[model samples]
Structures are given as structure tokens and as C-alpha cells.
Target: MKAVAGRMKRWRNSLRLRLLAGTLVWIVVAVLAAGWGLSSLFNKHVSRQFDAELGTHLDQLAANLVFDEAQTLRLRAPLSDPRLARPLSGLYWQVDRMGAAGEPETVALLRSRSLWDAVLAVPPDALADGEMHVHHVRGPNDEPLRMIEQVLRPAEYPDQALRLIVAATEDLISEPVARFNDLLGFALGALSLGLIGAVVVQVRTAWMPLERLREGLAQVHDGRNAAIEGRFPSEIQPLVDEFNGVLARNAEIVVRARTQAGNLAHAIKTPLAVLANAANRDDSALARVVVEQVALAQLQVDHHLARARAAAAVQIPGQRTAIRPVMEALVRVMERVHVERGVQITVGDFPETTAFRGETQDLQEMLGNLLDNAYKWASSRVDVKVAARNGDLVVTVEDDGRGLDASVREIVLERGVRTDEQRPGSGLGLAIVRDLALLYGGDIALDASPRGGLRASLRLPRA
Candidate 1:
């Protein structure tokens, strides 16, 4: 129920739904308006028929009423005229007269017995000759009647006026029009129901492509597929095609990255073996010199390996990770490594600085390299900091110890090019760090820290 209610709410808030519902309502309204207009027109036509028939009856009644020279009024028609005897039928007639003549002729002219005792109600004011008008009358059954009345004077006695009324029950005049109205209402209802059904079908048909799109996305998210391909409606095919293109490109890049890692491994290992062999040889002073050369070459190989490994750890655009945990883990690992040396490394406090746009392990490895370099050379302490600056992950590591030669400043970052000949190390620390930075699509530079020691700054891309 809740889900259905939510769906209804969403539909109600949607512009498309509003348009559909508005259209259906307008259609129903139009039907009702047309029905009302047409019903009124048809009712007028029915009333005209009644009026025409009544007019004919009035003419007949007028012809029948004639006054002799004595001004005596008499009805020539029988009370049983076929028109008047029809019960529950539509037609009626009545005639009224004042005294006419003979024996003071206090007799009535004519009347429909349908009125029972009641007389037709006519205007009190005199009517001109042939001036047709309408009046209300009552039947003997007491039902309402609409009488079309006319006043007439015979040709011989023009002063003696007569009222001739012809009428039919209002029900007779209105029945067909009422039936038309009922049918019109039923038709509007049926049309509204049909329109609602069509609206539902239209909405489902229109959004079917979107549903398919969501299912395609779900397949990719579940790792069951790397790309989407299906027949889509023409309007939405472009969007699905673009998303498929992205997925295809990402899949291609992943394959290339894997291949590059393997090739980089092969490229470094052969040279590394040669270097190890050369470094193991001990023959002359120059041979001892060859060991230094070979040791440096091996350092370059190791740096290449680290670079190849870092390549696989890179994140795509718009990706992000929590940095503090990776940083803390590295710090703990470094502290554990230097436990025997009594080195106290203090990481700066930046509590809310967690999010960064890079792979977690890559950042941790980069920090590890820079801090390890500091740990090796620092006489007392090393300080590390991380913060975001101008769309970069800005990392700074500082140590208070002897700095390197200004001339060989850049050479320190070259693969295996250590400034100190007697440091007795592989000399690939800075080089490996540089390669890792480059592999992760970032950069690192060495400079004098504010504490008069080596400061290394690493900048990785932001999301």
C-alpha cells in the first residue's frame, strides 16, 4: 500500500501525468458540454413540434366557433372528437366564450374534460386577432399542460372575441429529450473510462525504454556484463548507446593496463638479473665500481616494478576514497619498522581531512615512500601533513636532518641516482616515489623543508 501510494504521489507530481489527466478531463468535459448543448437544441425541436400540432388544433377550434346574427355562441364539434378521447396521448383543446344569444344562451362553447373542473389559465388582458400565445392549463388528471392559445373573432361579429386553446402534457413534449440526456451522460462516462485505460497504456509504453535502461545498468553493476546491447526505442537509444560506449572504453583500458603491468615486469626483470650478476662479481677496483653501477641499475629495475604495480591501483575519474585510514595504517607500519631506533614521528592533526580522489593503497604507498625517506635520514623526528589545496591532494613530509647537495637535487629523483656514495643503500627511494606518483597520474618534488631538512610534496588529482 505504501509503495502504491508513493507511486501515486510521484505520478501526481509529474508533469506528464498532469497533462494526461488534464486531457482526459477536458475530453469528458467536452462530451458533457456537447451533450448539454445538443440536448437543449433537441428539446427545442421537440417543443416546436408540440407547438405546431397545438396551432393546428387551435385553427380547427376557431373555425368551429361561429356566432349567428343574434350573437349566440355554439360549439359545432362533438365532445367525442377522436382527438380529445385519446387518453395518455399528447393532444388537447378548449374554447371559452361569453354570452352569445337565444334564451340568453348562458352555455359553454367547448372544453377538454381532461381539465376536470379547472379551466385553462389565460391572460386577463385582451389579445389582438390571430395573435398567438402560450398559456398553462390543468388536465382532469391534474397534470401540468402547456397550451398554445390564440384569440379569434368571427367575420360576421368582429367584436365578439373567443379564446381557442390547444395543449399537450409537458411530459409528452419532454420525454424524448430526457432520454437523450441520459444517453449522453452514459456516453461521457464510457468515454472517460476508455480514456483512463488509454492513458495507463500510454504511460507504460512511453517509459518502457527507461525500465530497460535501468535493467541494463543493474546488469553492469552486478558484474554480469561489461556492456549493454539491445533494441531500444528510437528516442532513448542515444543515451543507452553513450553509456555502453563508456563501459566499453573502461573495459578496454582495464585490459590495456593489465597488459602493461605484465610487459613492465618482463622489461625490468631481465635487466635486474644482469645487474645482480654484475654486482655479485669481485675482481678488481673497477670491478668494485661495476658493483656500484649494477646496484644502481637494480635500483632502477625495482623502481620500475613499483611503478608497474602502482599503475594497476589507479582510480577512474570521479572516484574518491577515505585517506585518513590509509595514512594512519602507513604511520603505524612505519613506527613499527623503526621501533628499535626510537624514532618519534608525529602526524599532524587534521581531523576532518578524509576524502581524496585517488586509490587508497596508492596514496598509502606514496606516503610510505616519502616518510620512510625521512625516517632513514631524520636525526630526531619527522612531521607529515595532508590537506586539499586547489583541486589537489597536497601531501608534505618534513624531517630535521642533513639536506642533500644543491647541484644533485634533481639527480636524487632519477632512478638509482643517490647523492651519497657511502649511504650503502639501493638509492631508489625518491625514484620509486617519483615513478609511483607518475603512475597514479600525479607528481612529486623535493625541496628544503621549513625545518631545514628535505621536504617532499606530492600532489594527486582531485575528484
Candidate 2:
């Protein structure tokens, strides 16, 4: 259920989904409108044909009517239609005599056998001679019918005027129209489904290039490629080219920054070296102060230079350094350097595939400081572990030495703050490590190690 909700949210946020839904809605409305229009037209046409049939019958009845020598009206021959002879057959005709002038009464004259001793209840309307009118009337069986009637004066008997009507049950028109409507509904329903299917296919096909662009960007993010790769449609190619241009500009900026940092370092170190030499040549109180200040200035220069280099390296994309190899190399060097101390360096649970998303030098700088500090303080053993967690690569270096007070842990991370002044160090090791980690969008923390010394936990971006 949660997965379904998540998919629903994604669908609501997607442009393709919105477009397809809107198109389908329009299709349904259009199909319904067209279906209604066709049904109405078909019904109208059927009604006209039914009225025409009734008109033909009325004409036939008029042609057949005659008057005997007694001046009484009669049909010379029966209607040619067989249904007209059957009682209550839903098809019938009737004749009536209109009252003479100044009279409002009408009298029944003759009717088809289908009337079955019953009369058609037509409305009493004044119809002109030879003019026809249509109406809804009750038939012999009390069924609804559509009737067409005409009034005329017989040529053989000018004194007598006759009204003629022919009708059929309303179902004759309704049944065919209803059947046609059902068929039209089914056809439109099928057409709607087909259109929806086509829309889905079209939307997916039209958006396929965007999907490829996304995959290409992912590859660049993961350090697999320097820029977007592959051919694209004309509409999308410009976007790809613009993005590549941005990446190129960013790369140029990072390179220039690194070069400037290096030049500044070299330019400062030369004068600092000259001051150190002059202070060594004279052994006075002023010389001692000059040496102390020169050392202080050198520390500051090294600190800022490392920061500047790390800041520039962080902006350089597509940099990945394998965790296992770097850690192994660092351990070998630390073990060799601290061999006389009898400190044993061991690796634990390090994944070969885990990688840091930064420069190799930056990774080595952070890990190197942490491991060297651990080795320097440890009495017998140091352990290093590397793992990936929460989209970060965590490298923990623990040593079996006297751990610092919990209150001093945060202070030790500050520049020029050392827990033990007796230790031969400028106190920038942990500070540099923290700065480098942070520059790479990562962090470093110091905690009490379970092995009895400090634990330096370094969290860096993972690739």
C-alpha cells in the first residue's frame, strides 16, 4: 500500500502522466458528443421514413375511395398491404366526413379491418383540403401511434368532404433507433480504448530522449564520464551541449584556483626560509623571537595552503578513490614509520569496492593524519575499518592508547589546540583532517575508542 501511494505521488508529479490524462479526458468527451450526434441524426431519419410510409398509405386510400349512385362514400378496392387487413396489427387507416359549413361536428365514414371494431382517437383539428398533418394518437389496441391525416372533397361528389388518416405504432421507429444507439455506444467505447492506448505509446515514445539524458547525467555524477555522452534529438542536443559547457567552465575554475594556491605557497615559503636562515646565523634574544615568529608564520601558511588546495579539489568533478587501496597503503607506511614503537596496525572489515568521491590526495591527507595520530598515541595496537553507511563512506581509526577527556574532544579539533603539548606536533593534524572532510561535503569527529584510545571517525561522500 505504501508503494502504491508512492507511485501515485510520482504520477501526480509527472508531466507525462498529466498530459496523457488530459488527452484521454478530451477523447472521452469527444467520443460521447459524436455518438450522441449520430444517434440523434439516425433517429430523425427513421422518423422521416416512417412518416413517408404513412403518407403513401394515405394517398392510396384517397385514390381508392369512391361514392356509389346513392352518394354514399366507399373504397373501390382494399389496400394492397396485407397488414392492413389484419385486426389490431398496429397499422391502420380511417376515413371521416367533415361537417358542412357553419357546423362543428364530424362523422366516421370507413376504417381498415385492422381497427378490429375500434376507432383511432385522432384530435379534432381543422385540416384544409388536400393538406396533411401529423399527430400522436391512440390506436385500436390503445397503443401509441404516429398518424398522418389529410382532408379532401371527392371529385365525383363535391358536396361530401372526407378525412383520411394512416398510422403505425410508435415502437416501429423507437425499436430500430434504440438498437442503433446500443451499437453506436459499443463502437465508441472500443474507439476510446484504442485512442487511450495510442496516447500512452506516443507519450512514452516522445519522452524517451529525456530518460536517456537522465541516465547520462547519472553517469557523470558517479564519476563514470566527464560529460554527457550519446547522440540526441535536435531539440534536446542543445541542452546537453549547454550542460557540457557549464561543466567545462567549472573544471577550468578549479584548475585555476589550484594553480594560484600553489603559486601563493611557493611565493610565501621563500621569504620564510630566508628569515629562518638569518635567525639561525645570530644567537641573540631578538634572533630567538624571530625564529619563534617564523615558525608561527610557517604553520599559518601551511594551514591556509592545505585549506585552499582542498577547497579547489572539492569543486573538481569525477574524482573517485578506492577505499581499500588507500587504507592499505596508509597502514603499511604507518606501521613502518612506527616500527620501533612495536605498534601493530591491522585492518578490519574494509570493503574493496567502497570509494570516496574526492581526490586521492585529499583522501590520503585525511586518513593519513588520523592514522598517524592513532599510531603515535597507541601503546600496542591500532585498528582501521572502512564501510559505507547512509550514502557516506566512514573510515574509523582506533588505537589502544590513553584516550583524552570527553570535555576536550571538541577543543582538540580546533587549530593550534593540542591535548598534550609534550607531543612533537604543531597541533594542526586533526584540524586539517576536519577541514578537508568538510570541504568534500563530509565531516570528521573524535570519540572514545572501545579499544581504550581515541576513535577518529571520518565520513566522506561515497561513489
Candidate 3:
């Protein structure tokens, strides 16, 4: 579960997810708002136009309602009027008159049965006396209605008033508006999705390099590699360049530190040794004790200097060194070291395919130290094998000399630890090898060898 949580955090914290999510929300809000505003404006404009056209129709109706030689109202209309025959025709008008002031209205004329028997109901807030206003009303057929009103006055009867209402079913006026709304809604939705998709693509493509950079940093942090490389986005390139710069600076510092320690060791060793010689002179018991203490101090300095030197050696990017050649060289050195003791050293067969990764010098230092310990302690034959298994390189050395007691082996690889009686050396060689293995993200351990001798195995990762 912790592993799952870690992976989830890794994904969510990525720049691509943040950028794409932010952009998608931004576009959705902006585009949807625009679409809504457009839809509203379309409705207002179309309603105004329908009202104006209906008013014109009402004017024509009023003009035609003249007395035809008989003082009675009559409608004048052309038989060939194109608007009358249109299916779902948008044009409609009505006339309403009162017999006297304060009387109820009576319908005088109507152009279509779309109103059925119901009257056009205007908004209660509509102004009287030559005011034009928009309204949504119920029509004769019980369908929705859009309508307007204009009071028509006959020239002959100016004192009397006639109401001229021009109407078009809101269904007609609204049909196109509805269709436009649908089209606009779909367009907006599609555009918003496309914008979101574009944002995702942009963020994903842009942030990919950063992801690789993070992984590379992790590898370096884990001591698996020394450097990283690749092109980066403009925004993050400086960080990458800075990181590389830091690595270079650190390498240089390590080198300088190693050189300074070596110099200090060189300057201190001779004087200290001369002082020791004087102290070790005959009949100088207290001075001899002082010399032993001085020797121990000198030994500590030497070990620290060795560690600094090992750390100073650096490798640049894309450079790999195999372990076989270094192993062979160390074996030759060990043979010379143990030749007087008549110890037989046998190195295992490692194919070219089986290789450990590191600098030749560094691998040599680590392997040389381990084998030197084995040769010093072994009575007869010493066996060594270096091989690759499961992305790891295994180096095992065994000796037929007296095997290490479990308690002694435990302290052998510990830093600053030495044997109880002070063996030949300060017991720092194995410690140095341990430190080097840790630097490469590897480990070393001691156990019983197959030949009833001590076994030393180092497991290192393949680059």
C-alpha cells in the first residue's frame, strides 16, 4: 500500500497533470460563458425582429379595414398574398375594439386560426397609448406565442380607438433561435473539449523531459550514476545545467581534497617517523609508549587520506569500465604479495559477457583490497569468482586458511574497527572496500567458505 501511494503521488505531482488540468478548467469556464452570452443575445435580437415584422403586418391590416361604400368595417387583402399560404406561417394579426370607453374588448378581425379561439394575452406591465412591448403569451391553439400591439386610428373616426395586434407564434420566432442555440451549444462544447485536449497534449509533451530529469536525479542520489544528460524545455534547462555544474564542482572539490590530504600525509609522515625513531631509542621506556601512541595517530591519518584519495577519482557521463581487467591486475599483484607464503590463488572463469560496472581504477582498488586480505590469511589455495546475475555482479573470494569466527567477521567490515590484538595492519583495508562498495550502491559481507575457510562476497549493481 505504501508503494502504491508513492506511485500515485509521483503521477499527481507531475507538471503535466497540473498544467493540463488548469488549462481545461480555464477553457471550459471561458468558452461556456461566451456561448451562454451569445445564446441570450440571439434570443433578444430575434424577439425584437419578430415583433417589428408583426407590427408591419398589423399596419397593413388596419389600412385595409375600410368601409366599402357601406360604413361597415371590412378587411382588404389580396387574394394572391404570399404570406397567407405559408405552412406554419410566421405572420399573424388581430384587431380588437371597444364599443365605448371602459367597455370590454371585442375582436374585430384575425388573419389566422393559429390563435384558435383564445385571445393574445400581453404582459400586465405593458404600457398603453402608442407603446410597443414584447410579450410571451398563450395563443388559440394553446401553443406558446410572441406578439406585439399597436393602436390603430382611422382618419375618419379619430376620436374612436382601435387596437391593432400583430403576432407570430413564439414557436415560429423561437424555432430558429432554438436551432441556433443548439448549434452554438454543440460548437462551444466541441471547442472546449478540443482546447482541453490541446492543453493535455502541450503539457504532456512539455513535461516529459522534466520527468526524465527527475528520474536521473533519483539515480544520482541513490549513488547509481555520476551524471545525467538530455535536452530540456526552455523553462527548466537552467536547472539541468545548474545540476550538472554542481556535479562538476563537487568532483573537482573531491579531487582537491584528495590532493591536499595526500600532501598533508606526505609532509607529516617523515617528521612523525623521525620523532618515533628518537622516542624508540634504547632505555627510553616512557618515550617508547609515546612513540606507539604517535604511530597509532599516524595510522589514522593514513587511512583517512586513503579514503579521500579513493573518493577523489571521478567519472564523467557515458563512460563505463569493466571489472575483469582490474581483477586480473589485482590477482597479479596479490600473487606477488603472497608468493613467499606458498599460497595458491585460483581465479574463476568470467566470460566477457559477465562484467561489473565501475571505473577500472576504482574496481581495482576494491577488489585488490579484498583479495589482499584473503591471500594474507589463507594457508593454501584461495578461490575467486566474478560473475553477473540478475543485473548484479557477484564477486566471491574464499581461503583455506583459518576461517573467521562469526564475532570477528562482524567487526571486520565496520568503519574504524580493528582486531583486538592489532593484526599486521590497522584493519582498515576491508573498511575501505566497504566504503567503496557503498559509494557504488553495493555491499560486501563475510561468511563461511565452501572449503571450510572464510568467504568474502561483494554484490554490486550493473550500470
State the C-alpha lDDT per candidate: 0.71, 0.89, 0.73
Highest TM-score against the true fold, candidate: 2
TM-score per prediction, in order, is 0.51, 0.77, 0.66
Instruction: Score candidate 2 by lDDT.
Output: 0.89
**Candidate of highest lDDT:** 2
Candidate 1: stretches off by over 4 Å: 1-9, 68-71, 78-83, 86-91, 98-108, 137-142, 221-224, 249-463
Candidate 1 versus the native: TM-score? Answer: 0.51
How many steric overlaps are in each model, in order? Answer: 6, 0, 1
lDDT of 1 by residue, 1-463 (tens): 9999999999989876787778777877887788788888889999888788777777777767766667676657744447576554545776766334311113336666544445555545456667888877666566778878666767786766666778878887778888888887788778778877888788778877878888877655433455665889888888888987886677578658867776876787677677667757757787777776766666565566566556654523334667778888888998998777677888877656456555565666677778888888887889888777875677888888887666777888887576677754666777777777787667887888777888888887654
Residue 50 lDDT in model 2? 96
Q: Rank the candidates by TM-score, best first.
A: 2, 3, 1
**lDDT, model 1:** 0.71
Q: By summed lDDT, which 10 consecutive residues of candidate 3 come out lowest?
A: 310-319
